[model samples]
Each structure stands twice: as C-alpha cells, then as structure tokens.
Target: MPFVDLETNLPASRFSEDFLKKLASTTAAALGKPVDRMVVLVKPDLPLFIFGSSAPCVVLSVAGIGVTDTAEKNRDNSATIFPFLTKELGLSEDRIVIRFSPLEPWQVGKNGTVVTFL
Candidate 1:
C-alpha cells in the first residue's frame, strides 16, 4: 500500500472532486503499486508559508514499502509527481515539496494488524 498526504495553502475551491483520485492514481502508477490499496489525504486552505510568503504551497508526503528505497527511485517518482502537481495546481515547482518515505513492512499497519503479518 501507498499512502499520500497533501497539505496545501490553496483553497478547497482549487480542487475538483476527482483531484485526490487522480493523484492517487498517479502516485500508484509512479510507485508501481495497486491503486486500490492507495490511501490519500488532502488538506487544503491551511496556513502555509514558503520563503516568508503565504502563496500557494504544498507539502506532499508519500510513503510505501520499497517504493522509495533509493535515491534514484525517489528521483524518478518526483519526476512524475512534481510536474503533475504544477500543472494541476497552477503552482511553480519551487512552491511544492515532495517528501518520500521508504517504510518497512513492519512499520505499517493494515486490517487490524501489521503489514508484515499480511
């Protein structure tokens, strides 16, 4: 499973109903994971600042087991995600930060148990 959390200073009006679904799909494709197992959260209209400005900015965190296990894999994932965010949000690449967390199976829980058990 892949989990994606997006926190943005932009308003909710900036997003369509399908935005999260599309993001989840893109992230799943980028990570080579199943979209059905993706969990995505989006928090918009939050107080965020970048370079001391309250402009539109996003902190996107993606986590999964083995998906971001290497620098090269992270770079490859960012290559796909960064541009998609820029185009969809109408923000500059510099205004968005994508953090990739390589998680261990034991660190994640699912179906009332640890992922390692699944």
Candidate 2:
C-alpha cells in the first residue's frame, strides 16, 4: 500500500477542494488505480522540521492526525505526497516513507507539553 505523511507549515485551509481533486488525479495515475480507490489524509503540523539527508534523501513523519480507515486510503495518501516530495524538494520518491499515526492530542507531547490547535 502507498503511504504518505506530510508535515507542513501550511494551514489546513490551504488544502482547497481543487487541490484535493488535483491530488486525487495525480495520485491515481501514479498508483495505477481508480481515483475513487485512493485515500488521502492531510494534517497540519506546524513548528515541524523537514530535514535533508547527505545525498538528497527525504523522510516524513506525521503525528496527531487520522485519515480514512482502509489500506487503500493509506496507500493513496502515501502516493499523493510523491509529487511534492520530488518536484518541490528535489528528492527522490524512493527515499521517502510517509507514515500516519492516529494519535490523540494528549498522547503526542513534546517536553511534557501536549501541542494542540483546539
């Protein structure tokens, strides 16, 4: 299954319907699956770090979010992130792994402080 985890400084509102549609189209094409068969999960992770490896590598880990409850959804979510990871960041998709952690606000904490937008 394709899996994608995105950690961006951008706000959730920025992910408009048009963007989702485009993402669905692109992801379906990449995965060789129907658009409806794909699943996508978008999370807003502010104050995050997107680091680079020694030789153009990318690793994304997202916490405190949940997407659809299906393997296809997970795969589609992962596939959707490839374009941005490759084009925007100049990193190969093969080097990246997107994982979703269905975590509660209280469960994910940094320095004993639970970070939440609510």
Per-model C-alpha RMSD? 1.0, 10.0
Which residue runs of candidate 1 sit more than 4 Å off their true CA positions? none
Query: Following a full C-alpha superposition, what root-mean-square deviation does model 2 have from the true structure?
Result: 10.0
Cα lDDT for residue 63, model 2?
A: 33
**Model 1, C-alpha of 110: deviation from truth (Å):** 0.9
Give the per-residue lDDT digits (tens) of candidate 2, residues 1-118. Answer: 2233454545667666776666556655645556674455655435544444344344454332344345776676666767765765455676556655555555545555764533
The TM-score values for the models, in the order shown, are: 0.95, 0.42
Indicate the residue-level lDDT of 98 in model 1: 91
Q: Evaluate model 2: give its lDDT.
A: 0.53
Model 2 CA deviation exceeding 4 Å by range: 1-5, 52-118
Pairs clashing within candidate 1:
none
Q: Which candidate is the best by lDDT?
A: 1
Query: Top model by TM-score, which number?
Result: 1
The all-Cα superposition gives candidate 1 an RMSD in Å to the true structure of: 1.0
